[model samples]
Target: MAIPTIRVGLTAATRTMAGTSAVPKYSDKENGIIATDRETGEKLYTVMIFLMEEDRAETLKVTVPANGLPNGLKPGMPVKTVDLVARPWANLFNGQISSGVAYRVSALELDSGE
Candidate 1:
């Protein structure tokens, strides 16, 4: 059973926070839980990006490397993500199936000339 994924590219209007969900300690081996580099031990942070879809505005949460996000990235600033992927996740809770999309990016860069 392979999870389906889709490649995507988007511009970010804002970045909210960066941290791990694990309490007391953080590890690099956990998948779909904590994002981190295997060799460098650098943790990946979850970033919330505001975007415009069609005629409406929406927010997307993506997991990116700690150093991958640009410095001084602020609201209304353009962001480019390479190898951005949207993965579908499903789980059973209370005898019901729940599903959602999980986004991740391999690299992030500030979009200049915007």
Candidate 2:
């Protein structure tokens, strides 16, 4: 069972945008093993959410399944994004603001035959 853990504290982003080589907000090292209901033997892995300086309040969030999740995740639920980028807009007042929530995408991984 691959456990979802929280990564160590990282540096904050500056007012200016960073290059492509910028480090990630969270890493696999922060994940850990957790216990769920004892009698039912049901367990769920919990992963940490990261909010970096570059990640504006409006940035989109997405969650992707690893090698687990047999039934697959639900759409419009919530998940972290595989990658983050500022949406392009001409002016500051344009659709540049961000919400603090992340959206979900389904049928990404986990299937009998790809």
Candidate 3:
């Protein structure tokens, strides 16, 4: 059976650090997996975003292929998550099961002229 995923799009602030090394570092075998670009064979990184709605605030962490994110993206910069999807995952841990949403995006671009 295929896992169902939700497609979502919204304007949010990029909370991840911005620089030549904006991507977070992780061991190749950490979490029993390694993230890489399939077509370009490049490493991937996780980006954090903050969504502010009225008085409620939420945060999401998404993985982006190396150099996949748009340039000039910085902290507190308004941006849009292009082709964003949320996949639900469940795993057995110790003696219990846990589940959460994993986010991915094809690109992150500045939400200008909004």
Candidate 4:
């Protein structure tokens, strides 16, 4: 039986926009083409966010849907993550192992503290 990978939910006490929310995500670095979500066939966007926990805050480059972010979002605006999940992936490239955590967000909305 194949073991299904469990997706861990991610949250933060506070999140703020760090950059433009409409930035396109590129899959091919050389070609400079925008990436897309395979399952839903939607264009992908990369958003810069700062997640604050306790006394620390770290910036994260998160992948989100092109249309998932509501308009009027700008840097320093307080936001909340919707249905956030993180998955770890690793692969061998040219005899070297490369690994990273990929975060997916269903949507980003103004923080209502709900």
Question: For all candidates, what are the clash counts?
Answer: 0, 12, 0, 0
Can you rank all candidates by lDDT, best first? 4, 3, 1, 2
Across residues 37-99, which tens digit of lDDT does each residue of candidate 4 receive? Answer: 987888899888888777888777778897788788787777877776776788998999998
Candidate 2 lDDT tens digits, 3-99: 2333323243412111121112233435744443333444433223334356553323333233223243343223323222222223345668644
Ordered from best to worst TM-score, the candidate numbers read: 4, 3, 1, 2
Clashing pairs in 1: none
Candidate 1 lDDT by residue in tens digits, 1-114: 566889875445433222222121134445445646666766777666655555576677777777666787655666666687899898998999998998877756776735
Q: Please state the error at residue 5 of candidate 4 in Å.
A: 6.0
Cα lDDT, model 3, residue 31: 75
User: Which residue pairs in candidate 3 collide?
Assistant: none
Instruction: Find the 10 residues in a row with the least total lDDT in model 2.
Output: 14-23
1-114 per-residue lDDT for model 3 (tens digits)? 776889975545422332232465354665745567666776777878876666666777887776667776677766666787999999998989998998877777776735
TM-score of 2: 0.19
lDDT of 3 at 54: 60
- For each candidate, give its TM-score against the true structure: 0.62, 0.19, 0.70, 0.80
When 1 and 4 are scored with TM-score, the better candidate is 4
Candidate 2 residue-pair clash tally: 12
